[model samples]
Target: MRGVVLHAPGDVRVDHREDPTIIEPTDALLHVSATCVCGSDLWPYRGIETVDGPSPMGHEYVGVVEAVGDEVTTISPGQFVVGSFFASDNCCANCRAGYQSACRHRVPMGSLGTQAEWVRVPLADGTLVPTPRVPPDDLVPSLLAASDVLGTGWFGALAAHAGPGRTVVVVGDGAVGLLAVLAARQLGAERIVAMSRHEPRQRLATEFGATDIVTERGDEGVARIRELTDGLGAHSVVEAVGTQESMMQAIRSTRPGGHVGYVGVAHGVTLPGEELFYSHVHLHGGPAPVRRFLPQLIDLILDRVIDPGRVFDLTLPLDEAAEGYRAMDERRAIKALLVP
Candidate 1:
C-alpha cells in the first residue's frame, strides 16, 4: 500500500509502506476514500515542529469499512463511516460528559495517518459513525470535513456559546476559521465578524455566514470588532488560528463576560496570566470532542442544513499530496482534499 510520509521538513512523498491490519479487538480497517490536509500538518512541514524519519501524514478521513475486529459490532464491513481526528472510548467518564476528546482511552489518529489506501481505526464503535448511506461523489468532501475542520469549527462555536442574539467574532481565515463562521450561523448567531486580509477568503467568509469582514490585524482588528459592537466587544469569539497573536485578538475582541472558543492547535506559546485575569473572558479549547456531536452533525449534512465541504476548493489524487501541502502553505488554497 502507499501512504504519505514526511521524510523531513518541506519534504513530503508518497512511499510504499506496510499495510495496516486489525491489531486490537476494537479496531477496524478502513479503505480510505477521502482525506484532507490539516493546518496542524503544516507545523511539521514548515519546520516549526521537528519530525523524525518518514512520519506518516494525515488524520481526517471518511471511508468504507473493509474489516473489523471481533469486538467491533455496531459497524460492519462495507459500511461507510466518518470518524473524528482522534479515537476515544465513548463510555469513559469524560466521554459520557461530552468531553470524548479527553476520554480515558484516547489515541491521536495522526499516529496512524489516514492519508493512505487503507488505515486502521481504533475504538471503532466509539470513533467511527456510520453514515445513513454511501453519499454521492460530491458529498464525500463534506463528510470528510466533518471528521476535523467542520467538527472543530462547530466545537469552537459551541465553546464560545454562540447562538441566537449573540455576535460572533471569528479570528483566522483558514478552513477551520471559515467553517467557524458557518457554525456560528447554524448555531443561531445574529451577526458574525470575520477578520481576514485575503480577498478569496473574505468572500468565502461572507458566503459562510459572516455579517461583516474586518481586514485588520492585532490591536487594529480588535478595535474594529469593538467599534461594531459599540465598544462592548463581540458577545462571543472563535479562535481558529493557534498563534499567540491570533489568540490575543480573539480574547481582546470578546466582551468581558463573553467566551472564547479556540480550536487552533497550540504550538510553543503561553498565555499571560495577568492579561487573562483582567479580561474576565471565559476560555476553553483543545482538540474537539467531535464524537459527541457526530450524530447531530451527520443529520445536518444529510438534511443539507449546511455545506461544510466548500472549504476544499482544490482536490488532488492521494499520490500528489505534496502539492496539497504546498498550496495550503502558500495560501493559494483554503484546503486541499485528497481522493484515494
Candidate 2:
C-alpha cells in the first residue's frame, strides 16, 4: 500500500507502506476510495505544530469495506461506507448522549492514514456508516465531506442554535465556514451574513446561501454585522477559524445572549476571563462530534438537499499529495481532494 506521510515540517511524501489489518474484533479494514487535505493539516505543514518524524496525514475519507473483524456485524465486505473523522464506540455514555467524538473509546482517523490505498477503521459498528450503495462519481465529494468539513459546519450551526427567523453570521471563509452558511440556511435561518474578503470564498458563500457578504476585518466586521441586523448583532454566529482574531470577530458579531459556535482547530488562543464574563456570549467548541450527525448528513447528501463537496476546488492524484498541500498553504486553492 502507498500512503501520504509528513516526515517533518514542510516535508510531505507519498511512499509505500504496509497494509493495515483487522487489529480488533470490532475493527474493519477499508479500501480507501477518496480522501482530502484539511485546513487542520496546514497547522503542521506550516510548522505551527511540531512534527518529529513521518506521521500519517488526513482524516476525511469515504471508502469500501474489504474485510471486517469477527464482532463487526453491521457492515460487511463490498459495502461502501462513510465514517466520521473520529472513531467511536457508539454504545458509550457520551455517544448515547450524542457526543460520539468524546466516546470513551474514541480514536482519530489520522492514526490510520486514510490518504492511502487502504486503512483499518477501529470500532467498526460505531465508526463506519454504510451508505445505500456505491454512489455516482459526482457524489463522492459529498460523501467525503461527511467525514469532516460539512459535519463540522453542521456542528457549528447546531451549537449556535441556527433556526427559524434567526440571523446568523459566519466568521472565516474556509470550507467549514462556507459550509456553515449553507447549514444555517438549510436550518431556516432568515438572514445569513458571511464575513469574507476573498473573491472565490465570497462567491461560494453566496452560492451556498449567504444573504449578505461583508468584506471587513476586526471592529469593522462587527459593525457591518450589527448594521445589517437593525443595530443588534446576529442572533447566532459561527466561528470557523481558530485564531484569536477570528474568535474575537465571532464574539463581537454576535448579540449578548447569542451563541458563538467555534469549530476551527484552535491554535495559539487564550481568552480574557473578564471580557467573556461581561460579554454574556455563549461559547461552545472543540473537536466536532461528527459521528453524532453522520446519519442525517449522509441522507441529505444522498437526497441532494445540499452540495457541500463544491468546496474542493482542486483535485490531484494520490501521488501528488505534496502539491495539494502546497496549493492550500499558498491559498491558491480552498481545498484539495485526492483520488487513489
Per-candidate TM equals 0.99, 0.98
Model 2, range 1-340, lDDT digits (tens) per residue?
8899999888899999898999899999999999999999999998899876789998989999999999999999999999988899998999999899899999998877889989899999999999998899999998898899999999999899999999999998999999999999999999898888999999999999999999998998988888888877999999998999989888888888999999998899888899888888999978899988889999999999999999999999999999999999999999999998
Per-model lDDT: 0.93, 0.92
Model 2 RMSD in Å is 0.9
TM match of model 2 to true structure: 0.98
TM-score of 1: 0.99
In model 2, the clashing pairs are none
Q: What's the residue-level lDDT of 262 in candidate 2?
A: 93
Highest-scoring model, lDDT: 1
Q: Write the per-residue lDDT of candidate 1 for residues 150-260, one digit (tens) a residue.
A: 999999999999999999999999999999999999999999988999999999999999999999899999999988999999989999999999998999998999999
